[model samples]
Target: MKDFLRIKVLKMLIPNQKKELILKQMKDKMNKILNYFKNLVAKIRIGKANTEILDDITVEYYEKKINLYHIARIEVNHSNTILIKPWYTKILPAIEKSILKANLGLVTINNGKLIKIVIPNLTEERRKELIRMNTRKLEKAKIILRNIRKEYNQIIKFNIIDIDTVNIYKKHIDIVTREYICLIENIFNKKKQEIRRI
Candidate 1:
């Protein structure tokens, strides 16, 4: 399935259009999945948040910008609050929608351009439920990664991809997998710490 010579050549050659095209496609595939899970875990961190809303809320802070997700921060004093600070003073309504859409069940109280979010303390049952939800998210990321791998395999099986190319793809897969796992685990640890607090 691989031309050993071609693989060696690809290594030495600056990626021409053909190589660039394949590399771009593979990178896109990798980013699409990696970004999705990272976003999910970020949302999960917000979800596990008992007192703040960090889910999918964005803010429009620039001059007359429309996309609210363009700006947002991830900090709440004492870990029980989320503050949404917008750059634009007029987009409170839109920012509110982003926060609600995030669906962390946090209420946004607007103070001029600043929105305050108070995170609630998690009950034992709720903590367990959040853990379960995180597991599902991780599984979904795995499935997506597999689907991308399958696509790469298709290219390999068709004899279009050389060994070097396949190896490169495999390397990306390994990197993404490790990065995402670390992110997910960090969220888990944070939530577990929160749940353990009496």
Candidate 2:
């Protein structure tokens, strides 16, 4: 209701051309934030056989460090087991060592030909801890959004002289910020559910 009243009081102080440019810039930044948040959530382990967990793990191959997925064929052999078959058998030990060094709390079994990663079931306490961690990440993303909104609002305030026009611009920023925040929250909730499920 307050926002509606403010909009009614706001005059046509700024040209639509300038307003659209500012809005486009803000939307671009918010979309980048949303994409980054999605990437972070994808890395969280959900007690299932998922190859995305190994996205950051790197193996030394011929004096070059390469991502695990680049050198091997990773697949879910079962609900709790990830089977990794390296293109070259010589890299098997290196891959196994890297997995152990990553400290992912997973068990790796090397059987000469391939490596098997057994994802452990999340204990009740561990699940709670993961939920907490997820919540922190969600909060961090929201903070980033708020900071972006603040930066844009400041820009609008400095350029626009009318107080009502400034308020209208700030309200638009708030609406976009809320939309992105809601998107991040939905993703966080889905991940929380995944962590809680057995």
Candidate 3:
């Protein structure tokens, strides 16, 4: 039976249930923040180690390798270049062809050894577009935070949880969401600065 009013005892159902529900809400916020900055993360993956960009690339032209992420290592060098070194030289042309099809401003220059790709600096127009994209992502993450609050309210509405306990959960959600938002904004600020450096 469902009780819409009176001591709803949301926690009384099970101690673990209450804890798990709270944890799930927190994870929702975490996922939102992670997804928001996913593209930015890909851009900043420029490190000394050999890692691939286009990690999600798929191959359809020839059944040869199926995807560049599977055959080549993507290394981001400097501020505007991606290095693709196929594990085997035989796939050099295939790699170049794949990149060309991507049309991501990638120019394939093979010195009979390795393929070097130059990621051009984002034009002022592109930078503005990226900024706008991230701002929208942040806004969506905030909206997710609001939805968590609504779920908390549902518990309170039916007296499922006591006032003190509900207050505690509310405070925890607020604190966690604020921290996540801060992280997202900090990342955005760093990327924005990089974009405008030139």
Candidate 4:
């Protein structure tokens, strides 16, 4: 009879412990998704010369494709120009070609030793296009968050927990999803404003 009572007590405790663990895991996953969206948005340029603007450019160096940053030093010379100086003079042509192929709407100057890039000012029409692009990216992020919430909901519903516990978990998941969606919107608005100001 003592063993039976102990077993009943442990069963009651397990549901609460499981609920806590699930909540923590959901929070962690949501945070990871938010961080990723931030990094993705940071790469979008807004009319100024930024080193990260060249991050996506890959140069064909020594029969292998490598990132431009790995083989050269990139610096912002002024509000509108970026200077790239490679360690080896021979790779200058390759770097120039890579930047041109990237098609970032910037002009490149190669003087055989150092490369100078001029970032053009954004026109009103260009600003509108950029804003649209930003919106598209944000929409994609929101979709990913929704998918994550759906998966977690399925997990909670399938478990053999009581109705009250299931309702609580579903509510927690909805709260977390709403919070992350709001964060994404805030980031989008900030970036859109910056692009328009440029």
Candidate 5:
């Protein structure tokens, strides 16, 4: 509220922009929130072979670290296997070592030319843990959306002195926020099912 008041006072001193532009900016921010949430959940392993799980792992290529996918061609050889063929066969050891260092609990088999990652089956306990982690992430995302809605609501309320206009903007913000929350929920539901699929 204090921050809203400060911004309200500042608005009086500065030139006002179109309210539609402010609403558009809020929608853009909400889209970013959803995208970030999707990326966060994509990294969670669910007893299947997904290349995105290795998106963060960096391997040493010519004394400089590079993303695992950049240095190699990663593919899903099977439901439980990820095949990695490095552009340079000599980097097999480095790639294998980097995957091991990541501690993702997968078995890495390095042949002379390529590396195979065998994703292990998720235990019941582990699946539940992953679900809980995803639930926490989902809650955090929703909290962010609510906070953003509150911030925008305050801005609209202070800037537009008319009660009807302020209520309309607040209502629109609420609707958009709910839509994003539903999207986040759908993603989380799909992920939860994946984690439980065994």
Candidate 6:
């Protein structure tokens, strides 16, 4: 009789444990998706010269591909100019070539010692294009969020102990989903404002 009661208690606790574990996993995955979206947004220039704009550019040095930041110092010399000074002057041309190939709509001036890039003012048409691109990225993030919700719902439906427990988990998942969606919307709005700013 004692053993039967203990078994019953264990069964009750296991489902709760599983629910907590699933919630934690869902939150971790959602955070990763949010960070990815933030990185994508960071790469979109807003008519300013930012060091992060060159973060994706890779230069060939010593017969190996290396990130631009690893070989040189990137700085914003002015509101619209970026200066890249390589530690070894020999790689100046290589860095210049990498930036050119990046096709970021910027012009590079290599002066033997350092490379300079001037960010041009965005025309009205370019601003519209950037907004459209941003909208696409926002849609992609929304789709990822929806997929995560679906996965959690499936897990809760299949593994939960009873209908009541399943409802609890579903409610919690809905709340979390709402919170993350709001966060993404706020980020998108801020980026749009930045792009439209003069």
Put down candidate 3 lDDT per residue, 1-198, tens digits, no spaces: 454432255545435466457657566757665664656444533222223456645654346557676766777775556677777887777777776875444456887678887665567776666667657766776676667656655654444346787677667666766776677677777766765674
Indicate the TM-score of model 5: 0.66
Q: At residue 65, give the lDDT of candidate 4.
A: 99
- Cα RMSDs of all predictions? 8.0, 7.8, 6.7, 7.3, 5.1, 6.9
For model 5, state the Cα shift of residue 26 in Å: 2.1
Model 2 agreement with the true structure over 1-198: per-residue lDDT tens digits: 975454433334334446777778889999998999899887877777888888889999989999999999999999899999999999999999999997667899999999999998888987887788779889999999999999789777766888998898899899989999999999999988888775
- What TM-score would every model get versus the actual structure? 0.52, 0.72, 0.54, 0.76, 0.66, 0.73
- The global Cα lDDT (0 to 1) of model 2 is 0.86
Best by TM-score: 4
**TM-score of candidate 2 to 2 decimals:** 0.72
Model 6: per-residue Cα lDDT over 55-171, one tens digit each: 889999889999999999999999899999999999998999899997677889999999999988899987887888878888999889888998778766755658998899899
Against the reference, the lDDT scores of all candidates come to 0.59, 0.86, 0.62, 0.84, 0.86, 0.85
Candidate 4 on 51-169: residue-level lDDT in tens?
98898899999899999889999999998899999989999999999899875677999999999999877998778878887788899989988988996787676654688877898
Question: Candidates ranked by TM-score, best first?
Answer: 4, 6, 2, 5, 3, 1
**Model 3: CA > 4 A from native:** 1-39, 45-52, 61-67, 73-116, 143-159
What candidate 2 gets wrong by more than 4 Å, as runs, is 1-21, 42-45, 59-65, 88-104, 111-113
Weakest lDDT window of 10 consecutive positions for candidate 3? 42-51
**Residue 52 error, candidate 1, Å:** 10
Candidate 6 — which residues are off by over 4 angstroms? 1-14, 18-21, 42-45, 60-64, 89-94, 100-103, 111-113, 161-164
Candidate 1: residue pairs that collide: 50-119, 50-120, 51-118, 51-119, 51-120, 52-119, 61-88
| Residue range 1-198, candidate 5, lDDT tens digits | 988677867478423665567768788998999999999888886777888889889998878999988888999999999999998998899998899997667799988889999988888877887888889889999999999999888777666778987887788889889999999999999999888775
